[model samples]
Target: MKVALKIGYEGTHFSGSQIQPDKRTVEGELLKALLEIGVITDTETADLSSSGRTDAGVHSVSQVVTFLTDNPRMALPRILNSKLPRDVWAWAYAEVSDDFDPRRHAVRRKYRYVLNADEHDISKMRDAAKLFIGEHNFSNFAKKDKNNPRSTVRKVEKLDIRSQGPVIKIDIVANAYLWNMIRKIVSALTLVGNGTRDIEWIGKMLDPDNYEEGIEPAPAYGLIFLEVQYDPEPEWMIDNYAIKHTNDFYTRESNRFLVISTILEQFVMQPEKGQDLD
Candidate 1:
């Protein structure tokens, strides 16, 4: 039987999503768990694959992974969670056809970037984000592959910027993305937000054939692969117990980070408005 699982992970310690020799990775951990549970003897025979690839330090809330397994009963989310590490968990699953390819069947991919809104002009960033809503050549905003170069033109179905408390959230929906596309877009939008660049500069970037400028990608830690949409969505079986466990794990992680952030805030040096510095 062919099965698909919706997995989530905190990618801080992972080298990346893909498997690498001598490096700890998300896929490596997942395959290890699968092996430990006696799901499959090898990766190739199982036909393991994932919806998309995420860079190191980039997190995900909804990543789809598919594989062929003879023992479907042992592949429950909660069952898998028992052997999987705390940082990575499977919360939902579905029975998919043998020919179903997660990446090829995906119609839309959504990503979210959380950024500190301390000095950014939210209005300017929103305006700049709108410019990326339609189809355009994104060569300037993406890192091209030399070995297998593909078209840089891609359509942005939605690009929204919202502010909450001290952070701003940037949500982007697209058909597909070129390498480093979202991070570069975030870099450009942030530049506009911080008043380093103007809206015209963003417009010029879309026309890479006429105007071109290198854009450094934003930090991968800020990016999150939120979800992937398919034409005929899978009837995922939600594992309530698995989800509860995931929430518990997240709560612990959240509290730890909150404390660390609070401590770091106290260490930030700032001068008083009327104080003179020698």
Candidate 2:
């Protein structure tokens, strides 16, 4: 059976999702676990593939991977999680067709970028985001690939900017994306919010041929691969136990970060007291 699994991972420590020769990566660790569990003798027999590649420090809660397995029982989410690491795990899965390609079959992909609301004009960001709601040549906003060139034109089905407490959330849904597309868009929108750029600048950026300027992408840590939408969705088998296990790991990590933030806040409040000045 060819099986698809919904994967989630904290990519901070990972080189990236793809397999790299010497560095640690999400796919490398995943394939190792699969091999240890006797899922398949090796990767060649399984023909594993992912929905898309995420850059280092970028996280994902809805990433998907598909592979062939002779023993379906060994591929269960709970069974798979037994060998997978705490940072990367399989939470849900489905038996898919042999020819189903996760990347090509995906109908739409959604991404979320969270930015600190401090000093940003939320209203202006919303205005800037609306400009990206349709088809546009994103050459200026994306990193071009030399090996395999493709059209830079892509349709944005939805782009929403909203303030959520101390952070602003930028949610984007599109048919697909180019390298560094969403991150660069975030940087541009942020410039508008902070008064460095305006709505007209955004309009000009979309017309890549007429207006040319390089845009640096926002930090990858703030971006999240939220989900992928598909037509005639698979009959996914949700593993409540696996979900709870993953939740516990995230909750623990969150608490650890919260404690560190509190400690940093104390230093900010009493910088001189904590400092060792000679």
Shift of residue 151 alpha carbon in model 1, Å: 0.8
Q: After superposition, how far is residue 278 of candidate 2 from its true place, in Å?
A: 11
lDDT of 2 by residue, 159-242 (tens): 999998989999999999999999999999999999998889999999988999999999999999999877868889999999
Best by lDDT: 1
lDDT, candidate 1, 1-278, per-residue tens: 89999999999999888888999899999999999998877888888899999989999999999999998878999999999988899999999999999999999999999999988999999999989998999999988789988899999999999999989999999999999999999999999999999999999999998998999999999999999999899999999999988898789989999999999999899877886868
| Global lDDT scores for all candidate models | 0.93, 0.91
> What are the clash counts of all predictions, listed in order?
0, 0
Off by over 4 Å in 2: 269-278
Reference-based TM-score, model 2: 0.95
